[model samples]
Target: MIKIDDYAYTSGLKDVHPVEKVSFALIFLLFTIISKNIWVACFTFTVMSIGVLFKAKIPFIAYLKLLFVPFVFLMTSLVAILFSIAPIYQEDLEVLWMAEIGLWQIYISSYSIQQSYELATTILASVSCLYFLVLSTPLNQFIWVFKKVKLPAVFVELMGITYRFIFVLLEKMNEIYIAQSSRLGYQNYRSWFSSVAQLIVSLFVKSMSSAKELQIAIDSRGGDEHLYDVDLSMGYNRGHFVIIFFSFITLFMIYIMTKS
Candidate 1:
């Protein structure tokens, strides 16, 4: 039988300790906040790429494909904001110099460069780091780590429930959609809209019914009073520390190199 959560479904980042994974992600966020140098951003990307490669063992092609998701949003936003601003004061800006092309003449005001580079670098780094972090960490482990970090328990619990509920809702919705389509539900625009609305309403009702049944089942099985318990003795292994440490070291080196 084919497993639902197979290699395609799960990221290898789940192997690392949750706390370590989150820590590295936060550090990347911090770097983005403090730096705007293109070289620095490039360096950070290199480090993050390495982290995704070695830490998660994700294929290079997979990483590029995943990276494209954020790149589209980021580049679109960057170009939109940058082009919108008019050059109030024309000054020769030193953009990437092409060999034998002495200082390509481009007029940029003070505010534009400061705004564009800072926004561009921070957004790219943030998106890239977050994508890797999410791919590596399981939703449950991420929540558990957040709790360990002393984040608000209520918020975390709510987020956890919402995350799980989304997939459940999607599964149900997909099933309903397939059944409806098989019955020729989309005969026209009016029919399509009405059918979709009805389908959603049915899904909500079914979900509520499931929730009630689940509650009854839990009560029947002892109602959270030792219904089930797991004994976990998680250890901090060498590989975990090694990967996290190297990520930081590489990040720091990138910062240093870019500064020089």
Candidate 2:
């Protein structure tokens, strides 16, 4: 628990509110949609990297590794799109393969390459921003920030309970699996499947009981009125809004200037 708390609260992004982090992320997405220009995307990425260091105190290399997993699809898509949209060579312009719509024909122009490169970079940069945001912030803080944004109370409460219980269920499952494995209960494939099936059914029953108990506990403590008693503050400030607003403006200008 201590280790988990340390990882959660002191991971270099504790000071940034979840809403601001999400807002910065949305700006990245907007940039991606507006321009496929490589230079603009690179500029946005560089700015975002510097901002991460200043605002979140995250080491660039550490966060880069965390982002690698989410970027795989982006990288693959960029490569495929770049190859598909790239212009044909002057000599190869007339060289057509068997008739397939849009596949064999090439435009053979400088603009094609520029457009494809721009699009690829925009996607990659946007994906990187989202990945960094998630790694830097804690899950609980996300829900807290959502409450202030006027998210439905029932939805928030349900999400919170689900998030809290998922870890609990994982812990219980791990204990059961370890004990069974130690006793050679999973020596055969069939036995392992059966054991897992039984474990899931058992977990479901326990979760249902736990939910009932939680409902009872809440009812005993004043139920629907509980949200009125809880303090939810919309903690926006000028600095936060200004930073986001300017970032959006700059990115929008870049998009307009470079877009095909």
Candidate 3:
């Protein structure tokens, strides 16, 4: 099982109703995206982090590693927002630093710096909200929620199949990678590229074979058109709902108080 999925099944919040968890996550995600207040973004990020690490009982190191994955990508993209290139430097521009390269000038302005900071916080905050959901709720529960909402059976089935396929591909890829590494397939840069190409091709072929086997199994089971029949009924804790409601109200109050 994937680390995140394992965490979800064993999470402290696993017993909480899927509806409650989904609503809480979506609400926080929407608020983080729509609110322009930096304080609100910071608060959301901190609160969600606490929920995931403390309430959900996810490992602190694991959480940091997950966050770090996106942090690298975020920093890479933020570079574009943090700096600008122009044919000539403007004397009146509020630049913190500048470099002259040939006839072009690359500069970091105070405004751009502020924008980058805000954008980074907002994105991280939104990601935290999503991570809370993913870390606490299993994919099966998510499908249950979708079905409860009367989502199309085809869509729900596709989601389940696609999620399963991802794990399958990952497992196959890992096995192939380990086998190759044992034979010193990645001893050099050239071999590494060749090994990666071989791995991709092997994964595609293996995935197709797995899909065919799955179809055969499904056909043997009655050839049902709808594969997912979720009968899960998770009871909601009123206390949790009350707590979340009051917590969000507190956040809104804080945002209003700090809006100036």
Strongest candidate by TM-score: 3
Highest lDDT model number: 3
* RMSD (CA, angstroms), candidate 1: 6.7
Sorted on TM-score, best first, the list reads 3, 1, 2
lDDT of 2 by residue, 1-260 (tens): 32333444666666666777788777776666565567677877777676666656666676666557656776666555444433233244322232234434333234445656766677667866765566556666767767777888888777777877877777778888897888787999998898889788878887898889888988987886543223435465669779889888887787677666
Instruction: Give the distance in Å from residue 99's predicted Cα in candidate 1 to where it truly belongs.
Output: 29
| Per-residue lDDT of candidate 3, residues 27-100 (tens digit) | 77777677666888898899899999999999999999999988999999999999999877456878799999
TM-score of each: 0.69, 0.66, 0.92
Global lDDT scores for all candidate models? 0.66, 0.67, 0.89
Cα error, candidate 2, residue 68 (Å): 4.6
Comparing 1 and 2 by TM-score, which wins? 1
Model 2: lDDT of residue 94: 29
Write down the worst ten-residue block by lDDT for model 3: 86-95
Candidate 2 — worst ten consecutive residues by lDDT sum? 90-99
Candidate 1 colliding pairs, count: 0
